[model samples]
Target chain A: MKVKEIMTKDLTAAEPTMTVRELIELFYQSGLSSVPVVNEEGRIVGIISERDIIEGALPGYFEVLYGITDMNHLSQKLREIEHDRIEFYMTPEVIKIEEDEDDLTAADLMIRKNVKSLPVVNKDGILVGMLRRIDLLKDLL
Target chain B: MIITVTPNPAIDKIYWIEQLCLDAGELPVMRATRSYLTAGGKGINVSIFLARMGIENIAMGFIAGETGRAVERRVRDEGITTSFIWVEGETRTNVTLLERGHEQRPIQITEQGPTVPPDALKRLLIHYKRALNRARYVFLGGSLPPGVPTQFYQELTHIAHQHHVPVIVNAAGEALAHALLEKPWLVKPDTRQHTEIAGASLKTPREILAAGKEWTARGIEAVLVSHHITHDLLITCEGAWDLEARDVQFQNLLGAEDALIAGVLSATVQGASLLEAARFGMAAATASAESEELVVTDRTAIERVLPKIHIEQLL
Candidate 1:
């Protein structure tokens, strides 16, 4: 089977101008942990995951990892930057697979890259669909 | 470039249930065995069909919140250029429940979309005016969203005319009323909302023909109206045609009208005459009606039904 046949065509993406609060609502409504960020032409420019937002919300995330600050004090600061745009937090580098590729290739990329989801694109680099780890396991089970 | 505008766009959801429990007496739990979701609106549907036919077109309108984002994604996936202006509330989602035994009568519940503010319309006009420079044809379709004036399409028609671009309007009621004042190049009164056209109830074929003639006589270039699923009547400056498609297998009737318009646009862009293009449009509508998918993507499905369309000239 091709990736296009199995990929989730119910794509929910975000624009560069969308705020963190808006992205949170998108994740909540779509039941998705991550979404690809596209330009005006709908070409994939970056990808943002729930982890990125959660970690970005924590002002002390990096300090906590280095054992510098207590993790329990991470409150009230999230509200301060709710208006910050997702473009600043999103990883501009994205790993995307073509829709016409073999399904196994998509599975391999996800497993090897340790990504929970991958944005599916066509030959012109336009975001077409999204594939998650659970989607890859559907046919197997 | 062809620009299609859908003032009220939606994310259409269809759920196929084995047996839908419609009993109001008892608490019902309906589980869908299958489901499909896609971007929907007359103009958006035509954009998808046109994109599949390798006709480059831009999908434009006001979209809001997450549903709006999904609509854009779905349209982009179909290779359409998107120029949607984001507004304040969530875009509406229309649900269609298709029961196993009763596939003919699908239950649809639609929500009124976000009220587009006046400023949003201003922004859209500015963008639309810029887009008109490259536009070969502009299509204004669907109902007017809340907070929008009834004469919005008519005003847009005048703007398109100022640029020497022909405009096609597919609307009903007041929106259709105002559009006629400007004399759009082609008018297709949306009969789905109300079965009335040109201030007359469309109960009989003769009435629909009369309604088409009424608009065409007022200096409108053409008027096309659906008589039923398999039949339609088209009136143009040169003549009128009553078109019908035979051997149509009833599957899903959604998007058939838009498919017809898309077919006509796709063929007309390739230099086909209005009569022949309307024939192809009927064939496309028949093929779309015969398929389970909302929009038929394969060109051969339309080609297979082309010869079966019977077009009889009137007047």
Candidate 2:
């Protein structure tokens, strides 16, 4: 079966210019930790997740990067870039799959990329839907 | 940012039933073979169209109850930014029944929508003014719900102009008439409800051109009038042009006008000339009319239908 057969439909994407605060609200509204970011032409430019938001928002993140504990500064860090756009923090190198690709290939790519959700594109490379890891576990298993 | 204001938004439940029974006697309930639920509001339709074309825009309006929430969620899924003001009562739900053979005349039962309380209208003004700060274009579409004054569009147009933003007024009857006095950038009166626009006849090509020219002469930038779903006449500051879509098998005409508005505005924002924009818009409308969906957004399919859309400038 093709990935499109089980992939979620009517997936929403965020624009790169959206503020971190806005993206967070979107994550809350969509109940998704991450969403594909698209350019003006609707092509997938990157994918942003709670991981990126956490990394980008938290102050003293540099120290925390080296495994230093800094939970106290989390609130301060989140407010610092609340208004900053997500372009810099987003993962520009996106690993996407074609909608028509086999379900086995989709699951294999997820394992290789170590990602939970993969953006699905059409033959024209336009973002269409998203295939979640949970969907794979439910269907492929 | 482009802001689309849908004064009254609705959830459209379209059902393709097995058959239509017209007798006065009691009949068995028809079964639906297919169905679709869409976010239905003129401005919302345009917002969806713009979003699908990769243009970021804001969909603003008043919403109420769970039906309203459903409409907002559906449009948000299309990637259109929504700034809805919550009101009391349930938002309207329009039921459209389409028979297999009579696709043209779908039975429609639409409610008047939720009443906008005084506080909600005030909040809308505040939000509208704030949105105007970043707005490049504003589209005021659909009719006012109960409790909202007819001069609502006029007031919004006046404020948008104060912010130096071009406003597109797409309404009918008193709403369109009041907005006209504000000299909106363009006026595309909603013709779905009535054959006549502000007591003006659009029955013939000559009357359509005359009517379009009348609005343009009122210091408005342009006026677009549709005729018989096959042709459209556009009168702009520079000149007038006639666009005719040939050989289109119209499956549904519900959202064609809104698609035209979106197509034109999308092109206008991209720096396309008025003539070119009208041509593109008519093609989009034609593509929409030929499909069962409310609005068709496939770029390739729309472009393929472009050549069949003939346009000629009027002397």
Identify the leading candidate in terms of lDDT: 2
lDDT of 1 by residue, B234-311 (tens): 998777888998877777888788889989888889899888889888888888888778878678989898988998
Taking the candidates in order, what DockQ does each have?
0.05, 0.04
Model-by-model lDDT, in order? Answer: 0.83, 0.84
lDDT (0-100) at residue B123 of candidate 1? 54
Clash pairs, model 2 backbone: A59-A77
Off by over 4 Å in 1: A1-141
lDDT tens readout by residue for model 1, A93-126: 9999998998789989998999888899888787
Worst 10 residues of 1 chain B by lDDT: B122-131
Docking class of 1: incorrect
lDDT of 2 at A51: 82
Model 2 chain B worst lDDT run, 10 consecutive residues? B122-131
Instruction: List, residue by residue over B40-129, the lDDT tens digit for candidate 2.
Output: 999999999998998878788888888987987798778676667767788899999988878878899999998888867875676577
